[model samples]
Target: MLGLRPPPTAAAEYTLGSPRHPDVRVRVHWPTAQRPTPAETGGLPVLIYFYGGAWTLAGIDWLGWDRLFRERAVDAGVIVIAVDYSHAPEVQFPAQPEQGWTVLEWAHGAARELGGDLDRLAIGGASSGGNLAAAVALMNRDRHQRPIRLQLLEAPALDLTLGHVDAGGVNKAIPDVILRQMAARLVTQYLGTGRGLRRHPYASPMLARSHAGLPPAVVWTAELDPLRGDGEAYVTTLTRAGVPAVGVRMIGQTHTSGGLRSVVPAAEHLHRDVVSTCVPSTHRRWTIRIRCAPRTTGYEPA
Candidate 1:
């Protein structure tokens, strides 16, 4: 359960759809202050966010994610558009990423009307949502050249194969073997019976043969999360491929630690780090300084 609060700014709701796909519900949360018109001043950056729920739970209306979106819109001074993508075991794999790409296409076409900066657009998500965000980034690269400036992944589940999961790194409340089994089931449920679907770049971004030509990314990983290795390996792969990427390992944090911001002080710090990352920086340089000791990393422009 989460405490409900009034949204920090005005939000507009709409539905986006294509003939082949189901209609996707979208909610756009505006920052408290915005330029009167896009003609006078380029509008605020837009962050198209997806909520995490292992691909089965959570929606744009989930109280936890709603609060995060509102906070990000107000604090980062951007237009936050949350996508309620179709869930798994029903919609499955490529459908979710397809829906995500549809939103990106709409944003590009309607940026001016929505008072958003086309060039400063970004996408982000947590857990399974992160998988979709990365998948969408790959789709943008392979399908069309969308001006997506960044991909912000928090506690992302990048490798659906579950090969990179280190159950021992997860919280010990549940046994490592059990955690491994649970993870396997989630992956199986989302992937369904499709053969070799686990290796599909849209289903598992880390399995993509090439990480080059994708937008710059800011990846956040919890030290105690079983998926931490997935995030670490992804950052390494992206960097080696000559993409601008940075990873921050939050020390002593777990997979669900992000939802503990109300009690855990460090969680608030993570929020600030994310909000700062959302802001459009001059020179197109993006950097995240790890506040936690012995585990911090950053990107400095050359």
Candidate 2:
């Protein structure tokens, strides 16, 4: 349970079961709207959501994020499918990535049954989940399979290299040694072999040989996050590959704020921005815009 509390919002009824992959389990969160008849849902898009927890702790029910995600999907007139990829230390290395891809594959066929448009699909996640989202997008591209229309990465940890601190100008409060140790543990566990740190595109999107032909991307970065540099570098890489990308830097926030979207207006706005970016012209063209408040005693932009 991770000692986390349940979301305050009313959750829709759904089911949890093994996906085709015996090792991977999926938790589907249905939208609150009445299920559409087959005739009524000929082309509704779906958003596949991945949750962030440093690729270890946390689950589908942490905070009210899932509820909010479903709400956003309903409001955007899309179906919301959340995947529960196996975590690290037990499942390790490429498991989450593989599980993520597997879930995406399932969503394509499953969306129709759930009354969604498989052709207009999108993927999104936060932090570690964001890392998975980017990786999966690359896999979809490299394999010459599945067309992803959009990608939403919120404060993604795109770089596995140890020297990102100097490049990103991370906050001084995060101890350098501790950061390295955590990264080392993650690499060792996730790859199952230390060789996972070799910077494979499947493991690290930053290492991908090409970002070309990938879908339009919406990347969110926190002004106070240690992973800020990786997100910026990713945006640059995407642009170089000619992929339409938008990067938004949230001021006065940290990586953890994403999980608290229910309580934070800024986080809520960030979620809305991601959904707005994914959906087709339902309204005005959505662009990543930065807003800042005057710095006070303890707040400053990175």
Candidate 3:
């Protein structure tokens, strides 16, 4: 369980409704520090973040990660936009993904209005959020010519079809029945009818027709998560497609560990990584060097 933390300094809220479905309501979170100003703070990169909670539970307000996102956005001199989309069982299937694209398109056009550089953009999320981010990146690459500079996926649920089997290589102590039940619930809610679930790239990004021309990516996986293999396979696909990708497996971590911001050391480390990746550099040109902390015996990259 996560402990309460002080909310981050309030940022301005912008209401954006779906153009295709005006009845559907959504909002975007913009960190206060990144507001547009003619004097300074202009031309900063934008990080559009999506939150995770399977396809049903959790919302923009459920986790305190927004505060952390704001802190990192300010510290890294980038504008952060968090989107609140409709969840499943109420809006089911392609609804959330479609809303995600709408938000992305809106953000791209309004980045300057929000004090973000249109040329430098990154998409990121955790768990289910990560899955959406990955889907968005692929969709953007295949459908449009917009530039996506980087992508960061933390414990992404890439392959919803994996069922009870551990797809990411590592396995936890959770019983198969419970895992299967949870997976079934998620799959059913996300795909609505499962009739053509396999054909939709948003439902199963791992089965995409092609992974070519995707932006450079940083894929994070937990050593104990059931979805770990999905993340691993994604990284492999990205690399094999000639895209630059980095895979990191957090030792002694689980599927929902990143959400345990208050109790997990791995969670804290993950936050640091997110900040490092999302923040824009002061120089026009940039170089990222990930220096690992010295490890003791038995600790190593998987």
Relative to the unseen true structure, what is the C-alpha lDDT of residue 209 in candidate 2, on a scale of 0 to 100? 81
Off by over 4 Å in 2: 1-22, 163-171, 282-302
The 0-to-1 C-alpha lDDT of every candidate, in the order given, reads 0.83, 0.69, 0.72
Q: What lDDT tens digits, residue by residue, belong to model 2 across residues 1-302?
A: 22234323223434334444335555544444455654676656777778887788877765455565655666466666776777777776576787888778777767777766666788888888888998888878776478677888888888776445332446677777887787767766666666645487777888888788988887898887878877877888899999988888888788777555545556666756665565555432323333433322232335
For candidate 1, write residues 203-265 as lDDT tens digits.
889999999999888899998899998988899999999998899888989888877666665
Q: Candidate 1 or 2, higher TM-score? A: 1
Clashes of each: 0, 3, 3
Clashing pairs in 3: 167-229, 168-228, 168-229
lDDT of 3: 0.72
Ranking by TM-score: 1, 3, 2
How many clashing residue pairs, candidate 1?
Answer: 0
lDDT of 2: 0.69
> Which one is best on lDDT?
1
User: Per-residue lDDT tens digits of candidate 3, residues 202-261?
Assistant: 877887888898888899988887788888888899999998888988888888776555
lDDT of 1 at 120: 82
| Candidate achieving higher lDDT, 2 or 3 | 3
Q: Which segments of candidate 1 are over 4 A away from where they belong? A: 1-6, 33-41, 283-302
